[model samples]
Target: MSAALIVLILLAVLAIVVVSMTVKIVPQARSGIVERFGKYRTTLSAGLNIVVPFIDKVRYVIDLREQVVSFPPQPVITEDNLVVSIDTVIYFQVTDPVAATYEIANYIQAIEQLTMTTLRNITGGMTLEHALTSRDQINSGLRGELDSATGKWGIRVNRVELKGIDPPPSIIDAMEQQMRAERNKRAAILTAEGERQSAILTAEGDKQSAILTAEGQRQAQILTAQADRQAQILRSQGEAQAIQTVFQAIHDGNPDQKLLSYQYLQMLPKIAEGDNATTWIIPAELTKALGTLGGTIGSIPVDGGGSKTRVDYDASIEDDVAADTAATNEAVQEALDAAKAAENPATTAADLPSQEEPPPPPPAGGTPQA
Candidate 1:
């Protein structure tokens, strides 16, 4: 009985070991590589997988999902002999688990090395500025080279990226200064252009304003000249009418010497009242005109006078009487001349006698005997 129990217990222990070794459970997004006697046999997928117990072994369990890897900065020399530090990131996936297990010993290390070499080659052909600015080109070259080289290793390089590129501190400062100077130059140019445009606009505005002002003044002057011309014409017409009326009235009245003498005496004071009467010239006919006016009043016939005998007033000096007579005769002659001149329709103020002239020498027969 003891020997049977021992054999059954041993069989059960062996069965558990075989089951544990044959059945493999792989997590999601993972693949297992089965090796038969140290040689690659087949690949195991996720979930339950069967393998030869104690003969086949799951050597590698590669993650089939995409993976990201970031590399540390590495110094590289550019075409211009400038050294710069660059870091990169790569995204990869395991497409074939069998090839990935059989091909490269360490596919991750190989991919990293290939990426570094490819990055150096791409940057080496460009200047520092070009290398710094052309990240997309560098990434493309890295991805192409890495994908092609790693394809045989069952690794697909899906994407490659340049994480950072750092130049020397001195070079960085110089580039910053250059950029600042460029911005300042652009600002100055824009300011100068603005000032030039403003000046042009201001000058144009002033020119237009001056032209408009000149136009307005010209119109005003034209209107003023027209108004003055009209005024002058009207004034001339009024003066002509007034002169004609006065001349006609004078002829119809036909007054005697006494009436003419009285009118002359009244006009003397008015003439003296002018603003320019500083040196008034008393005409020589003034005394004779006064004497004629006094004689007419004195010769008025009264009820007691015999036929109103005309009395001649005598001056205190004989020389005065002679001068008065001469002035009176000259006045009477001027009156005759004025009457004849007045008959002409072309008579003007200039045709009138200078001083006071007696009324048409009482028509030769109408003269009173003094």
Candidate 2:
């Protein structure tokens, strides 16, 4: 081949090689860090781009999207000198690809070691209980420290979380017991409160019942008193009606002294029959009643429809005296028999006063001449 033809062929091959080496296509959410002579030159964004063939080279490819990094468990000492194992997860994203490539070597490994050391340091200042309970505080603290430190490395730490914290077996057992005890205590307190409420409700119910019963009794008493008052009013009205009827009957009859004496004598027996009767006093007008009765008997006609013959008043008085004496004797005998039955058997007739006196001897002519 001619020398010119060989030169043209070599030029064509070189051009093709250069073009192939210079062309670069970055993927979505990614960036390429370019370097010249082992020094960072520029960063390439997503899309097609070109670089000086031999001078510029892609040194690092970085992902700009958020990522998760989980670290293995690391042993840490707490404030109480207890060793615990802790694992963590971190969320981060690369903001600047050039800085991420040049600022730090092995950024993921560096961050993991730093996180382990920082976690140990923080946990060293806290007891096991605080370390277990303060996960959010520790995570926030670790995230702040990581974010500040990784700013130059083009890494932004979004969040940090403690995946787990494992304590010693003895501590785990002790915590379980403590939890059980707390649950039991809460249960006991609840039971006691329930019983107290039940007792209070029962007492309240009993009190209400008692109050209602008392009110019912009071109402019943009031009703009984009203009934008694009404009954007494009716009884008084009935007695008044009876007395008015008796008075009207007597007025209608226009009874004489004889009728009056007869009615009084009839009432004496009824009065004596009552259990409350102790003694009865004879009226001072009893002798006048007898004389009136004798006068009425003398005025009474002997023959039916015959003009009244002149009656001897003194004879009638004598006859009345004898009749009264006989009636008194009989009444006294009856009263004596009743008194003997009511009294002790030792009582005799001699204890009583004489009811009859012997009438004055009749006049010698036997005409009841006075």
Candidate 3:
């Protein structure tokens, strides 16, 4: 019974060991590399995989999914000899577990070192300013180089990216200042252009206003001159017609010298009605024509009844004016005559001064001679 128990224990221990060596659960997205006696043998896919218990040895368990690796910042000297710190991230996947196990001892470390070297080489050709501004170009270049170099190792560099690039504090400040200065320069230029446009607009407005004013004045003057010319032409035509009508009437009626003389005398009062008239002249022909007017008036008919009688227009006007005022002026004249008779001796009508008497002496304080 003791020997049988010992044999059962031995079988159980062997079974556990064999099961441990033969069965493998690779999990999802994982692969296992198996070797026979320290030599390349086979690879195990995800899920239950079987191998020889003793001869086949699972050497490496490789993750087949994409992975991320972030490296610390590295100082690189640029073309201008300026040192800058740069950090990077790499995304990669293992397609073949066999080659990934044998080709490189540490693929992650190898990738990291290769990335640092490649970064230095690429950045070394560019100035700090160019490196700072050209991140996408640098990322693409690193990705291309890493993908090519890592291909043989059964590694696929899916993508490479720059995490951060930091320059000196002084350089950052200088860049900020330069950006600020450029913005201010643009603002000033725009302001000047706006002012120039405003001035031009103002000048154009004034020029247009002046031109419109002058044009309006010219049009008004033209209209006024045309109106004045038309009025003068009408007046001249009217005067010419009037003169022709008057000449015809005189020929038909056969007017004597008396009518002409009387019409001429009547025009004298109208000529004196001028506002600016200070002096006027009377023609010498008026005196001789008055006698003809008197003789001709005696022969003219006094009324439509064909009664011929001599009529004095001046004497008739004087008689009518005296008759209207005689009653009202009689009291005033009697008072004046009585007052004068008291102040001086009573004199007859013959004692009054006639046109033949000599003129009295000039009053004192009269106007001086020019």
Candidate 4:
């Protein structure tokens, strides 16, 4: 019983070692390459895999999933002889684990070196400005070359990207200054254009204002002239109506020559009232006007029972003048009496000189003697 128990324990120990060596637990999305006597063989996939325990061995483990590799910056010379430091990132995936494990000694290093060499070659054809601006083209070129070169090695380059490209500090400063100058120039041009537009608008506004003012003035003048003309027309109409009314009143009343002469005499004072008058010539027909006035007054109908006696200026004036003249220096006295009567009728009548009364008593005696 003791010998059997020891044998069972030894067999269990051997089984544990054999199991540990024969089975491999491969993680998900991973591949293990197997080698027989240091020679190429098959690849192990994910999950539990079995291999010949002594002669067959898992040489290398490769991740079938995509991987990322970042390369340090490398200095490259451009066509313009400008040195620029460029860093790159490569995305690759293992398609065949056998080739990824055995085809290349170090696939990561190889890819990185290839990336650097490819970047140098591509950038060597372009100036610094072009290299900085044309990053997509450089990336595409590198990816294409790398994908083709790694195809046999069971590596697929999914993408090649330039992480950064840094120019010299002096070049960066010069570019910044150039950009600022360009911006200033554009700003100045825009400012000038704005000012020009503003000036043109102001001038247009002023011109329009002036034209409108002139038009308004013209309209105002026309209106004023029309108003003045209307006023003149109204004044003339009023004057004409006044003259017609006066003429109609005179015709309707049929005033006599005495009334007409009185009105004419009243008008004479008004004509001489102003200092601007130069001449006051009496009418040539004054004699005819006086005769007409006398006739009109003598023919006037008396109202009530008033006597219709006519004035005889010739007899009264002749007798009085002859008598006064015979008594006191005949011719001289007659001239004096005529002058007094012509000057003022009331004063002359009261101042008539008394003649001798013997003529009245001798009148009867002379008739008997005769």
Scored by CA lDDT, what does every candidate get? 0.74, 0.75, 0.75, 0.74
Q: Give the TM-score of candidate 1.
A: 0.67
**Pairs that collide, model 3:** none
lDDT (tens digit, per residue) of candidate 1 on 251-363:
44444456756777788899988999878776578777577555443332111211111222342323343454454454445444545654555544344332244223333
Counting clashing residue pairs in each candidate, in order, gives: 0, 0, 0, 1
Model 4 residue 2 lDDT score:
100
Q: RMSD to the native, candidate 1?
A: 15.2
TM-score of structure candidate 3: 0.64
Residue clash pairs of candidate 2: none
* Residue 282 lDDT in candidate 2: 72
Give candidates' CA RMSD values in order: 15.2, 16.8, 19.5, 21.6
Q: Between which residue pairs do clashes occur in model 4?
A: 325-330
TM-score per prediction, in order, is: 0.67, 0.67, 0.64, 0.70
How do these models rank on TM-score, best leading?
A: 4, 1, 2, 3
Worst ten-residue run, lDDT, model 1?
A: 301-310
Q: Looking at candidate 4, what is the lDDT of residue 159?
A: 95
Compared with the true structure, what per-residue lDDT tens digits does model 4 show for residues 60-136? 88888899999999999999999999999999998988887768999999998888888899999999999989999
